[model samples]
Target: MKMKKKNKGGLLFLMSVVLGGFLGGFVGMFKAGAESNGIILDVKILIPWISAICLLIGFISILLTFNFLKKSRKFHSLYQEEMDDDLNEIYYVQMYRNLEFGTIAFNITTVAILLALFISVSEVVILNRSNLTLSLSFLGLVLIFNVQKYFYKTIAIVRQFDLAFFSTPKDVLEYINSYDEGERQANLEQSFRILFQLNQYVLPVLYIFLFIISFLTGEIQLLAFLLVGAIHIYINVMQLPMVKRYFK
Candidate 1:
């Protein structure tokens, strides 16, 4: 049974890698063809729309995040007051799942904002010298600052967890992993497993993205994609020995 499970898992991993690579190659080819055929988007028009959408999404995500945090804390307090109340504990877990989703949404928006800024600046520097890029760049910076403000507010709400604005990432991860055992711990582990799977599946696609951009832009230094791919594979390879030691 264990052997079968291992083989199944390996097969799934292989499938995911194959799928990711296929999609990545497809998109890269499409992008390259589009550029060659002069089917390009107008940056000045597209950027403002993207920025506005991100701003709206970011605001909604922040509000939902705060609401989830507040409900989770309330349930946590109730659970503490009546330590035997399983309902309170379940509610706490539910609220936290919502909070996690909200956090992911907010983080994705922030990344989008950063990407917008990078593109806007690159346009000004390389393609077109326009006031639109300058204005969009300023807007991106402001959105990023807003992201920081809400992010700090979130930390304040969860201050009981010993998280802070400037806390080292390792420290924050350690604190998170120190959650009370049982459902919360299981949920955290599940989240970690999902993230690991995503990394395995997405890293190849991301490398393809970088390679495509490099090819399009004539930037050979983007071979840093090789470095990224190496580190990702190395981490997975090293994990086998670590897992072996843990099992032993």
Candidate 2:
């Protein structure tokens, strides 16, 4: 068992290294292409295709997200209806799992929407000044409302779990005792830790890519990337004091 675990860990590390190298090479190739050929695409044609793809995917994600929210509500209702200890325990577990899955699904969909928004705005900027119009960017703006609606629905569904959502310190303590105790809370914290670690590792590469692309294109609007990258770094730095305090 120990050998198998070690082998699995090593395999994962190897795969990550290979994937990172491939991505780095791809970025380098793009940079080379840009430098040599002054790489440019016809945004008049490209923007429409990208906008269509984004809208189609965003619509599908929104539909699936609402479906997940409906399932969560169903699970919450079933959990409330159960009476026997064993049966209620089953329902409780199902409900908890549903909430966890729904939260992850919601986040994934939100990221897709945000990416669509980013690409839409980026493409708008890429368009020639004389040819620019909101008609090309309408889908992205539509997705902003979708994101807002999804955010509200996600919060509403989570709050349907009566034991969760707290308005006061006492309520928070009660919530911790009732819903977030033991392994569940630990898992939630561990997920955030993993995300933070991932951001730390990936953000530098992302910043470098942004710089490379901007240098190749001479587009100052890529300053957006710098602003976002700085905010990410600041957030990470802000968390360090708490991390030190925790260890101390």
Candidate 3:
């Protein structure tokens, strides 16, 4: 227990330091960018704005990471508890960790994209005053579609896990200690209903839309799309028990 306490203290310290650095860099980046650009760096004033935007993104990244880390630590603690014969607690605990991991990935990606967008915007604004000439007619569209495909898949996994964990009563959600059978049945029913809806319609629809958008935008987006797919697959695999139980 002492060791565990020390570990959490270390993690919190790290989170604080990281958050402070990100926030500092964030403000400094924009201040420098804006000062460097003066007033009208371009007709759109894109030069200064992009850096500021990235700064804002970095700020968001810090927040999400902080939240993710905190939540994961909590889950880790829960994981130490003894399990019942049903072993449902483990499933919920695992689900929470997986969700936290997914959130971490998403935040990391956001940070990357935030940087990329700033860099790309800067290039477009200053070094090269040029129109984006990449044709969206063929492969570009394909790449975009693929990215969308994976994005939807990722969303589906996250949603499925969320609903399953929240709705399933047997193992992870065993806390609905209703003395009355009617109340317990209602709780289970509500959970099942929620999962059923999310697993069937919400996830599929989201995937279709994501895939379609990528298709329309072009193949340039494929790499981004694949990352989304990878994360989705990860969460799906990670939330194995809850997903399967509700799904079946």
User: TM-score winner among the candidates?
Assistant: 2
- lDDT value for candidate 2? 0.63
Model 2 misplacement above 4 A: 1-48, 84-86, 114-178, 211-225, 240-248
Clashes per candidate (backbone, < 3 Å): 0, 0, 12
lDDT of 3 by residue, 69-168 (tens): 4555445445556465345466455645554464554556455445645555555666675423212122223433343344334434433322232234
- Model 1: residues >4 Å from true position, as ranges? 1-87, 131-159, 191-195, 207-224, 230-248
Clashing pairs in 2: none
Ranking the candidates on TM-score from highest down gives 2, 1, 3
Worst 10 residues of 2 by lDDT: 128-137
Clashes by residue pair, model 1: none
User: Sort by lDDT, best first: what order?
Assistant: 1, 2, 3
TM-score to native of every candidate shown: 0.58, 0.59, 0.28
Better of 1 and 2 by TM-score: 2
Tens-digit per-residue lDDT, 1-248, candidate 2 = 99999999899889978986887788778777866896663335566566557556656766666676666667677777877888878766776666556566556655665655666666657654222223433554575466446544554555532433224767645544555456457877996887676676666556766765565455754666967677777877878987999999
The C-alpha RMSD of each candidate to the native structure, in angstroms, is 5.9, 6.1, 18.7
RMSD of 1: 5.9
* lDDT digits (tens) for residues 1-248 of candidate 1: 99999999999889978987887788778777978898763435565556556545545654565566556556545655665667866765665665566567667666665655666566567756554545655665675566556655554444355455567968877766666667467877897886686576567667766766665555654457778878787767867975899999
TM-score, prediction 2:
0.59
